[model samples]
Target: MLKKIRWMAVVLLTGLVMYPLPLMADHQGAGQNSTLVLEPTVVTAGRIKEKKSDITTNVTIYTREDLEASSIQDLSDLMLKEGFMVREYPNSTISVAIRGFSTDTHGNDLSSSVLILVNGRRAGTGNLAKISMDNVERVEIIRGPASVQYGASALGGVINVITRKGKGPFTASLEGTLGSWDYKKGTVSMSGAVSQFDFDVTGSKSSQGDYDTGSGSEYRNTGFDSKERFSFNGGFTFLPQNRVGISYSDYSGDHIGSPDYLSANDPDDYVNHGIKSYDVYYDGQTRDDFLFWNIRYFKGKDEYETHDGAMTPSRTYWRDTDSQGAQAQITAKWAVAQITAGWDWVDYEVSNSNTVAGKENTYENPAGFFMVKTKLLEDKLVLTGGGRYDEYEVTSDTGKVKEDDNWSFSCGAVYKITGELSVRANYAQAFKMPTADQLFMLTDYSAWGMGIWSGNENLKPESSETYEAGIDYTRGSLTGSLTYFHTDFEDRIAYKSIGGGVTQYTNVQGGTLDGVEGSLQLDIGAMFGWDWEIVPYGSFTTFLEYEDDETNEKFQYTPEWSAAYGMRVNHVEYGLNARLNFTHYGRHEITDYEGTGATTLGPDTVADFSVGKELFDMNKFGKIRLKGEINNLFDRDYALVQGYPSPGRTFYLGLNYTY
Candidate 1:
């Protein structure tokens, strides 16, 4: 793999030298430059943002053009692309394993290594709440442990979604989609100024029929998700040295019918799963030449209720979870160097999950950090360094564990050889804290009759350091990048079996991961009055052998090879868009461990498609649009999850109107 990557790099550099291309063709291309949302996320932030020309720790930026051209609805759409491991559940819910950490299963508690963020705010996971993309401006995927700054859930990486900021003329955009299998969706958005205040409101609702398992069997899928989002911003430019602005957003949604367990042949009896969430956030910013700071606070609550008909005791399980956090950050630039510092605090509470008694659970953690970024070597080389410290206390039914602390730091530098060639490298430390289940979810399934396997009150924290580097070169008509990364996890958290079916949560020493991936973009130039492009990409990851130290048996649900690839087509006017997505997975080992006799999971492939358009442009007074999308385009039968097969040939259509 290393040799192959080297060859690709040589070819890329030689090609660039042979024929020069626009350094920012995507940026200078007609019809796209005016799109502020498409601008590099660093538009305002002083940080020297990552560009396609340099790779440091795997990161992918999906532009507004890519989103619109590909007709993507959510993260699930990324499944069609290689490198991303997406385990599809009924409906649109999917657990993504970007860069191999995903174990080819519907991501459950600790099943994924990625963190999903919306507008720099913490988004809850674990069947509680999910991040939506209706008003998303762009998505930033940082592919590695971000625990140094993100915390427990950010084991793999971070997905930062920038929301659409209110700007530009008083314009409105609307769209409608309608297609197969009782699929329908409606969307409406309007933005403009009323007096000195500017406001933007965008909302959408969608529903669809239960999808098939591609084997002609239905998984009892009949689930729908809906969200209502609104934002208001007020700002004023008071001369060359002053500016202030404030913004607020609120979102709420629901996803019904997610079960704890469903058998291959008995998918009918396992029904009744639901999740609802609400979020409210407010932020304000003030800036000057020498200094600036942004302050924000977010509050989120999630309610999850499910009647797993097959639950051991037929429990109508319910859990209520909420999080509140505040952040204050300041950035300053002085003599070719920019310094950023910030502090964050968050609290978590969970109310009952398995008992109708409504028991409440809670935990609190606080963190602080500072970073310095500088432009060196005549502003062509960039270097950054930062460190973070976290302290938290977890209190549960068992008892209280206190005095826990974690530390992480990172440094990186990028060198531009020319306007078109750049090279970069980075290193970061990330980790995850113990969850409630690990600390206290006890079980009596053992003949020992409710024996206890207590939490490690004095347990040391799990830690990891990642090293990554890459070079990117692009010339006219062709663009390409290569990225390579390696991670070493020390004292990783794990559940070690004690005896008689009971297990204890503890940290294990020695875990390693290595990966290499990249993507290529080619613009065939205007063909027949149409600007066209073809993007091809792939990723590969190797999870070193992991086993129980005591028994020396392999861990469950870890696949040796995880890889993905796809193509997209777009036409600006006339409103046409489409994609051919292919997903392939190698074999994996399942739980129910019995030495090397574990069950084999997937090593399969499947394809899917979608398209949409604006019906009429009758101005902001009113407008309508139509769309159609289908999953499992080829209807190939396959299963990414153990008995639960995926949906086949799913179709949807939606309509939107605005006034």
Candidate 2:
């Protein structure tokens, strides 16, 4: 532990000492002034508009331009391309580890410690596969505990997806893509604004056939996946600084096949999943710009069913969940300070198709928060502090009920030393409550000849305290950042097996996790008169200590290092662009239940290349774009997790037309 602390101190000191050399360079390239800053305004950091350099926490933003420049087609593809620590397998659920914290294990609910939000609202489930890539405006990645802004499930970090809204005249677009493995996708979208109203709508469809791995071996039960999605949003303005809006989204997946692990026989495992959400909100600001308010109501449903082969009647099950929530927040601005107070409530009901009648479970959570931001030293230094409290209760049909309460707080500061550099530090305490399944589920099941399994009524919330420090530097066309973070956890939740095959959810003693993230961006075209850009980034995470050694066993699934670099070239005169990207993952050790060592799984490399061209332009009809992408350029055969090999080299071609 002492060695790790010393190492982090050295890295921080080195970055600070070398921050000023780049500021003295001449700015004479073509786009030096235009590209001086690489970050956009983000809201997830403080619930207000703030630049990346002004925030005390580490954040990464992906804009519309960033999405268009990559070959990614979904949330899974984007995470992998951005070099985030993630676990994904074909036809299986995907999970993301934020600073080495995630809720992944056998018999667990597959929920994540990292919270996922859409437009500042919790998105119910943790399944990343349900998110659609179409009609997205930006993505913000907050890389530290955010329990003050968000409540439970925020013990790690936050990922927020912001959707686009209409501003000017009506515009419509159509896009289609075709790739290997019989993969196909199409989307249509329209957006516009009238005298007192604005609207945006999008619809998409996608499907894929079975594929083979790089080893030239067919992976059975890798079956097919077909999905459809539709999203709509509209807003009406009644007066200045006042507007009301409504949004709806629906997604469905049909006959998604899962790989069979028990045997190599034909995969008969399949499932269908669906999600529907509706939201209505009002945004207004009082005169004199002293007060602002936002009130919202949301309702959502998620359902899924799984079944094996036709001959296996015993291996079938289905679950459905419904959720409703309401949020109200008001902010006041005074001299050199801003204060925000908010309250929210959520209710959930879970039902099973195979369970007995009247066996459903219900859960409810109510929370409130207060936050304040103060500016001092002539606006060169900023301080932020906030606290939140949440109370939850669960009820089941079998006359069983449980309740608990928790509170969290966060504080941070950012100081600007020079125009080209800034320093920031933060401390936060976060927590995650037990899910309804962990408290009310009761089923008789056997795994590998094990006995019955049932849920435990007594469980405690998992909590953590995080400390972070970082520095950001930007000069001419160079942008870079280095951040170090550490977290200490207590009463961590885990699924354990008692005697007589009675497995239940319990709390582990404690543990410590720490990591460092660094990034470097250089726009050669805007600095050295070159016609290209280069970006290199990397992150490292490890377990520092654990009260119970078995807790460290699960850390083996997390890789020690992940790195990526990409180079892009663009010719404005010719309307052409091309890029090459490479990503690498360090070997990860697999361990047993008792923290004993096992074989390693990863230590792989993959590459992707893409090119795009503008075919033609019309004054009123807009323009046409043609693109081609190749993934797995070297045909690398590897998997981030065992028993799942990635597909070999694949090709894709796409076209987009706007009017």
lDDT of each: 0.58, 0.76
Give candidate 1's total backbone clashes. Answer: 17
For model 2, what is the alpha-carbon lDDT of residue 441? 68
**Candidate 1 lDDT tens digits, 429-460:** 87666655555555443454555555566556
Q: Candidate 2: deviation at residue 467, Å? A: 0.7
* The best candidate in terms of lDDT: 2
**Model 2 CA deviation exceeding 4 Å by range:** 1-25, 29-39, 103-110, 262-265, 312-315, 353-355, 529-554, 571-573, 591-598
Per-residue lDDT tens digits for candidate 2, residues 450-479, read 556566677788889999998888776567
Candidate number of the best TM-score? 2
